[model samples]
Target chain A: MKILVCVSKTPDTTSKVAFTDGNTKFDEAGVQWIINPYDEWYSLVRAIELKEKDASVVIHMVTVGGADTEPIIRKALALGGDEAIRVNSDSTDSYYIAAQIAEIAKQGGYDLIFTGKETLDYNGSSIGGMVAELTDAPYISLATKFDLEGTTATVTREIEGGEEVAEVALPAVVSCQKGMAEQRIPNMRGIMAARTKPLKVTEPVAADALTAIVNFELPPAKAGVKLVDAENVEELVRLLHEEAKAI
Target chain B: MSVLVFIDHADGHVKKSSLEALTYGAKVAAQLGTSAEGLLLGTVTEDLAALGKYGVTKIHQAANEALNNLDTQVYAAAIAEAVTASGATVIIFSHTPTGKAVAARVSAKLKAGLVTGACALPDTSNGFVVKKGVFSGKAFANVSINTAVKIISLNPNSYMTVAGEGTAAVAPLAISAGAAKVKVTAVNKVSGDVPLTEADIVVSGGRGLKGPENWGILLDLAKVLGAATACSRPVGDAHWRPHHEHVGQTGVQVAPNLYIAVGISGAIQHLAGVNRSKIIVVINKDPEAPFFKAADYGIVGDAFEVLPKLTEAIKKMKASA
Candidate 1:
């Protein structure tokens, strides 16, 4: 089974988020990048577990970004991906990125595709569905559990207030989240093996970015907290009702 | 050129988020000098005409049972057909799970620009620019859509639902919902009065609560406030609470009106999920807890000592009101 796992680089969760260039671009000056947690901790790890069960499974990691994204992709390779494909583009538009991945999926003819539920930077949960639509495959989002049997895949996904179990034929797209797999760290052996893994870079296919970033603005800073004494519980309630109007 | 809003429903009732979407769509239509209409794919028990009070002028119904269970591909196809037939230049969704599942698919099929988790109406004064939360609500981005056909999925609770006096004309839409590729086998619903995503107020607990045995106080507080109960990652990880109750960057992200955290330290991951909330109150025994930095109200006191009193006070306040 050939599985294509789409990965993206995002600022580390602890990094202070800021914008640059008249707020049209995210400031990368002091930002530390990591493989998006959902992609690394869930989607890619689950594929590795599936590979552990079947020796025939080959996991290929694909990322859409510039060269700065290589280290993150290489880390994913150390985690267990057999090969890596980088679409040389830095477009942040969801459609542009999905179109790039869809092109790679079409050429690879993989049986399964995996992506994180959404990227940490943009929080746009649109790529998996767009790729599924572009490739004419069934797409499942917010998958918490996934199991494969022969050519059929069973997925447990989160809905509004509950979970739903669904089954789809092979060659489907699954956007994974927590509960799908546990986080795994790359060992020295895996890290060394990743150094020898084939890293392929391809130019991005011609695709129009449907949307453009106009500007970014940070959320207003919080007014200093109102410290309520432990004895004055009623005052807190009064403040919530009268001052904050939250209750 | 018209605006078509997708009315998401379950068990024959329209969702609260969809109402917000309807109002948002109506306002966008008004901005563009066109009428706003609604499309309901499944059978609903609610009066379709009454939804016009949310500002829709017409309601299109596709009363199909298959459409009720959220098949993304089928729903996208049905919505695409509705868009084409209605000559809608813009589409609106609620940014709920159902909307997240299908909005991008329709955008892909129709080659329209799509923006999810939009926090405001489009700034049509210049071009079709939509403002949305980026970096998990740490910041906002104004995105411009260049496509002629545009889709916006409004984040729940972001827009107020304005109701006026009017009734919509319900029309039966003719379209095939197509075969569902993914077959749902079972649905396990979490029984709760308020789903965390739609709850106006949320009361959450953390590791400082000691264990699951002490959850009663938190539940009592939630019950009094009519709020949903959630948990920090550590609590969910320890299975003291179900994983569904976990709210963080990796878990469920909620933007409730009021979020009260008991014992949580307000880690960045946890804050990412809930920083969008209108108001935040942090209760922690440790005065140095990081959650106090982000909180609008903070009480440095033991949960065991503070919770019962706060719950009783809120309960009394509610009873008297």
Candidate 2:
């Protein structure tokens, strides 16, 4: 089985979200970027697990970013991918990125493609489904468990109320969330092997996105906490009615 | 000119998010100097004409069983055909799983510019710019779309749902339908009173609830308040609850009117899913918990002790009312 995973570099979840240029763009000036958490935990880990079972399983890592994201791509390779491909252009929007990935996967003849359900930064879970549509592949979002036998892949997706198990065929795309696998850390040997692996950079095919970012801003600050006296139960009830209106 | 809104339904009832999307679409339609019409893909039990209260003037219902389950290709094709038939220049959808998929496919089909997860109305002074949540609800980004036909998927709970006296007229849509490539074998639904994603009130617990054995306090509170129950990532990871009830950066993202966190430390990952709640209440024995700072109300007490009293008080109030 050939599995392709799309990883994106986003700011670590703890970073203070701020914008520069009069709040026109995200201030990437002094922030650390890590692999999108969902992509790392679900998409990448499951791909590695499949590679272990089928030695013929080739795990291909792809990213849409400039040269700065190479280190993250290399780290993914160290985590256990056979090869890496970097689209040598900064993706301006989710559609452009999805187009680039779909184009590549179409040319490569991938049996399965996986992506994190949503990016932590953009919060756009559109890439996987968009790619699936672009390539005319079946898509299953938020998969927790994925298994393959013959050409059928049984996937379990965590929904709002419960789990949904699906049976899909080959040449499918999946957007993965948690409960996919036990987290894995790169070992010394895997890290050393990654150094010797080939990292290819290819020019992006010409495709213009129809949308563009107008500006970026942070949400309003949360109000200071209000502590009501525990003894004043009536006050709490009244506040729940008048102030919070949560009752 | 007219705006088209996709109406999402599940198990015969229309979803709350779709109503909000309808309201959003209607508001956008007004802003664009156009009328708004709705397109229903699947079967629904609710009165279609009553939906006019949300500002839509007409409804195009395609009562096909093939649409009971979501198939983006079929939905996109159907919506595009409806748009063409209705002479719609703008399209709207909710930022749910089905909406995201169908909107993109429709955008490609119509060559329209799309803005997903829009939180506010567009600024049409110069061009069409829509504001949306970025950085997992930590920040906002304004995207400008310059296209002949535009597409937008509104975020849940961002726009207030408004109703008017106008009731829409229903019109049955007659279009050639195709068989869906995928089929739903069985639906292994998670058993709960309220769907977690669309719940108005949510009560979530974390590791501080101690263990799965002591989750009664959380459930008791949720039951009394008629709220959906959720857990932090650690609790779900521990198998105390199913992974589907997990709400965090890597889990389900919800925007309830009220989110009450019990024994939760409020990690950034967890907050990403729920920061959109209008009001937040954090109850914990430790006063130094991180959630208190973001909470509108904070209570420093043990969950075992506080939760029971809270549930009792709410039940008494409901009975009195």
Candidate 3:
């Protein structure tokens, strides 16, 4: 079995969002880049789980980013991916990114494709579905748990009010969410082996750019707190009614 | 051309988000020089025609025993058929779970361009462009759908539900519904009045509340406000609250009109899930807690001492009003 996993380079969770070059684009300066938490934890772990279940299964990881993103890609390799592919494209638009990943999946003929339910940065969650369509493969998003026995895979996912159990045949795409697996940290041996792991760099496939970001601005900072003094219970009630108006 | 909006429900009752979608679709159809129609699947106990007051001119339904249960494959096929047969140029669905699954499938089947998690009406000026969240809730992306038929899945709580005096003409579309291959033998419903994700107002507490027994104060405030109850990720993990009540990066992502965070330090993970909220009220004793930096309103007081008093005031206001 051949599986392909999609990863994205996003700002570390703690980075303060800012823009550069006169605020026209997101300022990448001094920002620590990491595998999008969702894709790293859920999608990568589930892919490793599949490889563990079957010895012949080969797990491959790929990302669409600039040359600088190679380190994050290597970290994913250290986490257990057998091989890696990097499409040298730094485009942030979902359609352009999807086009690049879709071209790779089409060329590779992967039996299964895995991506996080959505990336922390481009919360679109639309790419995997689009890639599935581009590949003419069935798509299942937000699977919490999955098992493969034969040609078909049964996936259990959480919905708005309840859970759903679905089954689809092979040669499909599935997006992973929280309950798929816990986040994995690469150890020393895996990191050393990742240095020699097959990391392939390829030119991006030409595709139509569907959308682009016009500008990015930080969310407005909030004001200071209105402390009512913990001991003054009456003052707190007065504040709630007069100031908050929510009560 | 007509725009069809799917009304999602649980146990035969329409959800608030569905109504918001109806309002959004109606406005979109009017903008596109078309009629706004609605499609009600599953069994709903509410009068369908009355819902038309929100802007729908007609409500087409397929209320079957099997339809009452959510089967994405069956739903996708049914809605796709409806769109094709009804001559629907634009089909809208709330980005809720059922709608998410069905929208993608129907778009693929109908060969339509789908833009999910749309925060507002399409930019219908030069062409059809939908603004959607790109980096989770961090940034916005405008996607242009240059297709004849367009599919849009609106994000929950983004569009306000506008009500006007419009009575809907009810019609049951005669279409064959597919069978659900997956069967649900039983559903163990979570014991809670307000679903954490769907609530317009969410009242969540963290370790600041002290312990599980002290949760009543939080619950009382939430109940008085008609708000859903949630907890910080740590509190939920600590078993102070049920897992379903967890709201943060690893838990549910919500964009309610109002989010009330009590005792939480406003961790980045928690803020990512709820930063899109229209208004935020943070009540934490620590004046320097990170949550204060994002709150529209911040109250510094011991929750045990403040929350109960706030609940009592709300109860009094509700009773007098």
In order, what is each prediction's RMSD in angstroms? Answer: 0.9, 1.7, 3.2
Better lDDT candidate (1, 2): 1
**Colliding residue pairs in candidate 1:** none
For residues A1-247, what per-residue lDDT tens digits would candidate 3 score against the true structure? 8899998888887776666766557777888888987788998888898888888888888899889989998999899989999999888655667778888998898988998877776566766766776776767777778788876788877766556677777888888887788788999999999999998999988875545454454544556545545455456555555675545
The candidate that wins on TM-score is 1
Residue A143 lDDT in candidate 2: 78
Candidate 2 Cα errors over 4 Å, as ranges:
A158-160
DockQ leaderboard ranking: 1, 2, 3
| Clashing residue pairs, backbone N/CA/C < 3 A, model 3 | A121-B135, A122-B134, A122-B135, A123-B134, A123-B135, A123-B136
Model 1 over residues B1-321: C-alpha lDDT tens digits?
999999999878999999999999999999999999999998999899999999999999998887777778888889989998899999999988888989999999998999899999999999999999999999999999999999999999899889998999999998876798899999998875588899999999999999999999999999989999999999999999999999999999999989999999999999999999999999999999999999999899999999999999998998899
The CAPRI classification for model 3 reads as acceptable
Ten consecutive residues with minimal summed lDDT in candidate 3 chain A? Answer: A210-219
* lDDT, candidates in the order shown: 0.94, 0.84, 0.79
B1-321 per-residue lDDT for model 2 (tens digits): 799899988778888889998998898889988899999997988899999999999999988877877766677778878988999988999887677657876776676888888988888788889898888888889998878888899887788789887889888887675766555566777665688877889999999999999988899989988899999999998999877788888778888888999999998889988998888988888888988888888788888877887787777777887
Pick the winner on DockQ between candidates 1 and 2: 1
Ten-residue region with minimum lDDT total, candidate 2 chain A: A228-237
Per residue, candidate 2 scores C-alpha lDDT tens digits across A48-82 of 99888889999998998899999888888888989
lDDT of 1 by residue, A1-247 (tens): 9999999999998999888889888899899999999999999999999999998999999999999999998898999979999999989999999999999999999999999999999999999999999999999999999999998999999988889999999899999999999999999999999999999999999999999989999999999899999999999999999999999
